[model samples]
Target: MLKEFKKHCDSTSLSAVCTQLTELSNQAFCVNNGNIPKWQSALDDVQNTQPGKLSFKPPYIAIDTKADVSGLTRSLKKLMPWRKGPYQIGALQLNSEWRGDMKWDRVKNHLRPLNGKTVLDVGCGNGYFTYLMSLAGAKIALGVEPFLLFNYQFQAIRSLIKEPIKAFVLPLKLEQLPAQPLFDTVFSMGVLYHQKDHKLHLQQLMDVMKNDAELVLETLIIDQQHGDQIIPEDRYARMRNVWRLPSTNTLQSWLEAAGFKHIKLVDVTKTTPEEQRATHWIGDNTQSIKDFLDPENNNLTIEGLPAPKRAIFICQK
Candidate 1:
């Protein structure tokens, strides 16, 4: 994957940072993760199957090709807890925990055209949206995911495709990328709340984008009645890494403070079970959004905080 990424980078604006990006990705891949062997084995199994063409099949990143459904399912299950997609391969349906298409529908039409654009997807789990960006005709869609498992999952999906798409997922974080104003469109979906310092996160996003580049920011948010923000004392919606939930107004202000222009809060939707639910594809821990909410009140999390309501803000750097 890095080889392909390097080749693609060499012919584009990313040429200047290709070597550094590949080296960092190599270091990340080399990190001792006990699950690597199992993940690699699963990836190898999928690669042996009949390759297919990838396309959007409504709620799925569909791959059209025949394969031993039972064997394919078993191999994919080895890389369990698929979180970001509900992909369809051949006759098999990998119904992941999150129906990512719902979120995609909310933001897709509002963004700038991606045709021939250099795009970046931060915190992209298994490159679900990255594939969408490439399918939308991006010159190259680079997805940076720090989680090693997701990278392996991405490779598993990529291996099954008959033809290579202009999308690639690397095992690196936003901070690891070179501070080059390169990407024309940058997406930071479901990532902002995880940062310890939201301002720094916004700043880092701004640093990597070209002037006038579009940024599609999506993260958990509170209603204006909840005040400017809420710093959770503990877990929010059963997610420990969530640092804070800001109001839409506050989020817009943060974008402005970071020097963004033409900021617009495009969509604000409260999460529902239909969008995030327990599915067999998620493996042993089938708990999902419904499990995280208070049994008596859907509007509150089990921890007595505001329920999961995400806001998508479109702006320019």
Candidate 2:
């Protein structure tokens, strides 16, 4: 992944962020190719691991994600996991990764609203959004992703930049991403639903960012409450596609608890519906989950379903 990042940064022009790799990132920048017992188990839920399994095993990478860049490709060049392409940034990406880019014109403004401003991107997959931030003119945009593959991938992209674009890779969890609260804005999108502990995750993110810092949140939300959530037998690291979509009241309360004074729902894409769904954009993704996510396409009404409404919750610390 580090190699890929280096190549990407070299291709672009942001080498500053990755001048030095953290010790932890250096440790995780490689992949262990041999498959472990747990590796086979985690893949298909065939053989599950013990509830408290904490030991590291072979096959350092797991989860078949469609990341534009793959760290697994570094050690073993022959193993090319099916590549998907023609990526497009839409309502979801805009709400999440592109949220900080308040205005649209990327060329004119450089999308760098927080120029000379410290920034942190939690759950930054593939670091594509991080790239956008750099283009926008952010002084520094450090991305944090726990996935071994993604963590190194971000590091790799940083390594290549010609001009310095500050980024760091720390395997630390959201709850453990340092407590300095130095950033001016912390952005997280499509990340809250993936956390096993939603409340704690919320607390952790808020803790890392500075007071009066902007918290841009984008996640799947249900229009109405359902009695129960559909739990997947074995989902993404025990997380859900659509976990807790805290009601506007619940989210408002949590932000307040996290020392956020202003909480507002900036936009609701469901009103338009078509442009936002990944099916319209991520055609590769739709091949598997057909019909895509058009609520109008199908009369489906279940809370937290795949096609649940998505909203952006902006909070000021």
Candidate 3:
């Protein structure tokens, strides 16, 4: 995958950042993620299946490959707790933790045309949406995910595609990316609230985007009545890394402070069980949206904080 990214950078306008990217990718891959051997084995197992064609089937990022469904399921389950997609490979339907299509439906229509554009997807898990971005006609869709397991998952899917599209997920984070204004469209979805300094995250996002490039920023938010923002004391919904949950107005102000122009708060939808549910793919602890929330009160999390509701803001660099 790192080599593929090197080839991509060498052939595209992104060559300026190639050296830094190569070094960062090498460092990322070498870090001991603990599950490397297990993940590598899973990738190897999937490769035994014949390569197939790819397509975007609205609710699914599907592969038209023929293989034993039992074998496919057995191999894929090794990478448990699939957090981001509902993919299909032949008769096997991998229903992941989240209904990613729901998120896509909310923001897809509002996005700028992807045709021939260079795009970036920050924290892209398994490159599911990255594949969609390429399918939508992006000249190239680069996804940066620091998690090595997800990077392997991306490779697992890519391996099964006869002629995969221009989607590539690298084992790197947004901060590791070279600060160059090259991407025409940037998507930082489900990632911002994890930052200790949300403002810095926004600035880093701005720095990498070309002038007038569109940014689709999506993350958790509190309502206006909550008085601007809530820096969670512990965890918002069972996960620990969450740092800030801002109001839509507060987010818009942050974007303005970061020098983004024409910010539009496009959509605000409360996450529900239907959108994020427990599935077999999620191993041992199959807890999901409902399990994380107070059983008596759906409006609040088990932590007694306001439940998860996300907002999407579209702006220009």
Candidate 4:
């Protein structure tokens, strides 16, 4: 495991961590064949990367032009043949123009000041978007996700960000987050619906935000009124409903319940320039999400897709 971690991630202090992890893994593994020794260094790195922080206005980063595919390859090699899903769509909606900060382009009237302030990104997969947020001038931007496979690579990508940017490999339901200062903004994309107890999970999320802290939330909306839908077997590589999409109304109500005063619907699904969204995850089926969005095609057929559309819901406090 330490060898895997070392192969994928690089940092000045990583060699030390690598050594520690190896010793720990061997000791634990030899002691009981019971559990795998898992240690995450990404979250803890935020403190080290955050000193000497400088403030600057962020430049727009349009991803339409080919991203340095090298970075994508680097992340994928470690993460494995994982596929993109609702999270990407939600990000597109937040920054439909793709200037890159996922802060819902030019919505400052509603968004609080974040330039050089601390920002937290939960369930950040691969850290691509987290990097963009840091470039957008967050004093310290931290991502929390539990997959060591990807977190390893995400940490290596931190160097590209001149400002403080860190990745934390933490469980979605982990009871405690770093407890020093509260975050100014939290970006949680497409993660709310994954838990079994929806209300409790939402409350737990609310616990992390400050009184007026911004929350850029996007998730699979399960309409509270209508019954929840399930993904049938075979449609997904995993079992049905690993994702529990929420309805717009339900999300809005939850925001209010959570004390987020201003709630707005950014868009259910955004229309990205076909070229901008092209990737290994999205194939020739340009109509993949488009087909799902057509109102006439709202039905989740035997073919696939619970609904005919991918929607983005950006709500804030």
Candidate 5:
């Protein structure tokens, strides 16, 4: 993956960041994650499978391969808790916890054409959207994910494909990246609320963006009726990392304060069970948005805060 990334960087304006990126990826992938052995074993299974034709078939990011379905299922289950996809491998539908295509549908038509553009997908779980970006003709779609398991999952999928698209997921965080203006388009989806300092997060996002580059910002937001924002008293939806859920107006202001221009609030939709559900792929401890919300009142979380409503803001840096 690092070698492929270098080849990609060498071919574009991103060459300046190549060495630094390589170093960061090396350091990240080397970390001692106890689960590495199991993850690697699963990746081995993916690698052994016959090469497949990859395509975005609406709800599925499918690979048309002639492989033993039962064996493949067993192999994939080893890397369980599939969080970000609904992929089709041969005839088996690896239905993940999140129907990522639905999120793509809400944002795709609104995006600037990706053809020939250098793109970044921050917190890209297993690089699902990264593959879609590359398929959309991005010059190169670089996905940075800190979670080591997710990086391995990405490699597993990449190994199954016959042709390598210009998409690569590296085990690195946005903060670890050099503050270089490289990407033509940047996506910070489902990441901001996790930041303790939202302003710094926005600033870091701006730092890597080329002049006039577009940013597609997606994060949990409270309704304007809930006042400016909600600093979660504890947990928003049973997840501990969440920090702030800003109003759409508050989010727009933050973008303006970060020196972004032409900020546009493109979409605001509540999360639904259809998009995020408990699946066999999520493993034994299956829980989802449905479990996080109040059974008595769908509009409120179990913690009694505003339910999970996400807002998408597109702006220029």
Candidate 6:
């Protein structure tokens, strides 16, 4: 996968930072994570299965391949808590926690064409949407996720595809990326609220984008009724790292302040159980949206804060 990524990078504007990116990724893989052996074992088992054609079968990043269902399931289970996708691999349905397609539907139509464009997907869990971006005609869709397990999950899916797909996921964070104006389209979905400094995060994103590059920012936001923003005193919706939940208006102002132009607030939808529900594929910890919310009031979390409501903002660098 690194070889393919290096080759692809050499063919694009990413050539400037190709060596550095690959080295960082290699170093990440070499880290002493005890789970690596188990994840690698799962990846090996997946690679042994029959390779197949890949497609978008709505609600699934379907892989049309024949395989031993029981064996395949067992191998995939080793990398549990599948959060982003609901993939179909032949007879098995790997139903993930999030029905990612729902979020995709809300943002797909509002984008500029991705055809032949170099793209970046920050915090791209297992490259589900990254694959979609590649399928939507991006020349190359690079997904950078800091989580090591998700990178392994991505490889599991990639190993099943008979043909090489243009999508690739690297085990790296936004702060680790070379500050070169490379990508034409960049996505920061479900990531901003996790940052300690939201403005720094936005600025870092800007530094990596080419002139007129489009950024698709998606994160939790509160309604104006909650005030300009809410700095969570503790956990929000059971997510410990959540720092700030800005109102849509405040978010726009932040974008403007960050030097982004043509800022547009595209969509704001409150999360629902149907979009994020527990499935067997998510392993033993089956708790989900309902568990996080107040049993008496669906509008508030167990912590008495507003429920998870996300907004998508599109702007130009």
Write down the lDDT of every candidate, Cα atoms only.
0.94, 0.47, 0.90, 0.45, 0.91, 0.95
What ranges in model 1 sit over 4 Å off? none
Worst 10 residues of 1 by lDDT: 7-16
The C-alpha stretches of model 3 lying farther than 4 A from their native spots are none
The digit string of per-residue lDDT tens for model 5 on 172-240 reads 899988888989999999999999998999999999999999999999999899999988878889999
Stronger candidate by TM-score (5 vs 6): 6
Across residues 33-64, which tens digit of lDDT does each residue of candidate 6 receive? 99999999999999999999999999999999
List residue ranges in candidate 4 displaced over 4 A.
1-79, 82-110, 159-174, 178-181, 222-243, 270-305, 308-317
Which structure is stronger by TM-score: 2 or 4?
2
Query: For model 6, what is the C-alpha lDDT against the true structure?
Result: 0.95
What is the TM-score (0 to 1) of candidate 3?
A: 0.97
Model 4 has an lDDT value of: 0.45
Model 6 TM-score, all chains together: 0.99
In the range 41-73, model 1's lDDT, one tens digit per residue, is: 999999999999999998999999898999999
Question: What is the Cα root-mean-square deviation between model 2 and the actual structure?
Answer: 12.1
Candidate 3 per-residue lDDT over residues 11-98, each given as its tens digit: 6768888778878888888886789888889899999998888998968888898889999888888888788898999888999999
TM-score per candidate, chains pooled: 0.99, 0.59, 0.97, 0.56, 0.98, 0.99
lDDT of 1: 0.94
lDDT of 3 at 280: 91
Task: For candidate 2, write residues 242-278 as lDDT tens digits.
Answer: 4565555566676677677767777644423322223
Model 6: colliding residue pairs: none
